[model samples]
Target chain A: SQQGEEDPQALSIQEGENATMNCSYKTSINNLQWYRQNSGRGLVHLILIRSNEREKHSGRLRVTLDTSKKSSSLLITASRAADTASYFCATAAATDSWGKLQFGAGTQVVVTP
Target chain B: EPEVTQTPSHQVTQMGQEVILRCVPISNHLYFYWYRQILGQKVEFLVSFYNNEISEKSEIFDDQFSVERPDGSNFTLKIRSTKLEDSAMYFCASKWETQYFGPGTRLLVL
Candidate 1:
């Protein structure tokens, strides 16, 4: 499995500040996706960036993928206390025709009021 | 909004016992997958089922593991002879293109 490795295992930010987390994979990917898990609950899909796309935004979330570097970044702007959660990056490896994903260890974000 | 649903948020079983996890995928979704996450670990894929059969499975999905779509809506994962290491969070996901995950079943094999 081509699991992505996330940097800065934990992050802390004040409300209204921006939060960014980076993920790196060792293999080529068909697409990269970001998911958020509140506590031990299920994962919520945030965004997906294809190998060809550079950047994408959904509401206050921005995802940037760099295929050449095999890395991606997730940015959350104007963070709120409710946004505190563990964010994971998953990669759909190009060699995996079934589209099975490999997930990262996740970044724990703490948003304080 | 349609989403995947799972039953029995938690399950506790003795070692060597059998356990089955159930999931109901979105009506329109075509692909169903199973993943497991141990506490403090990343989620790992177990298997992917489509067209009423298994399309792919990982090394971790061995003879002890099996999956089935017994009905049009329900998908199941059965673990034979659960081990202590099998204690983890199990998630079921459905995908048309992007996947939607169901709340996981926390399995505790003692």
Candidate 2:
């Protein structure tokens, strides 16, 4: 079974709108990271938030982690068409050695002009 | 900024044949990993290597699968006698702490 699952399997938003996606995980984690993938391409690392951190920001991207709820959310402010892609949330659990990551099903975001 | 690179952006092979996917990780990175994603499915971890040996592998990585760092820069994944189910985008990742992924090699096993 997959350790993480993302909500809103698909999302569509207009340029300049904010797009938000949520992810839930099954176990305690060392950290959670978000990645973006354009169609038929490899994943691009976006941001990572440690278990102890509640929120983090990088440019227009913001990520929040709520360990108590076993959930995390990624928010893209002022979205652009270039942001259209699949977003995945991966978890690095405390019990996992070698820092292996377990990924979620992912959310597909389509930003339109 | 340096990034991981993968060779043979696409490969098509018969079901019973063997296929090798190659990757060149960032020069200074110490850890290497392979992941795969079936169409419409989430990315799945296949294996992780460090210190020139496999450190961990998922159930999906079975006897048919093997990984090797033949030289200082190249990491390769070989599938012996590939099955139809092996068709997917294979991604190679490297990390010191945070992982950086290569563009991926799409394998189509017919």
- A1-113: candidate 1 lDDT, tens digit per residue: 47899988999999999999999999999999999999889999999888999999999999999998899999999999999999999998889878898999999999999
Q: Which portions of model 2 show Cα errors greater than 4 Å?
A: none
lDDT of the structure predicted as candidate 1: 0.94
Task: List the global CA lDDT of all models.
Answer: 0.94, 0.95
- Using Cα atoms with residue i matched to residue i, what is each candidate's TM-score against the true structure? 0.98, 0.98
True-vs-predicted CA distance for residue B54, candidate 2, Å: 0.7
Residue runs of model 1 more than 4 Å from their true location after superposition = none
lDDT (Cα, tens digit) per residue for candidate 2, span A11-103: 999999999999999888999999999999999999989999999999999999999999999999999999999999999888887888899
Q: Kindly report which residue pairs in candidate 1 clash with one another.
A: none
How many backbone clashes does every candidate have? 0, 0
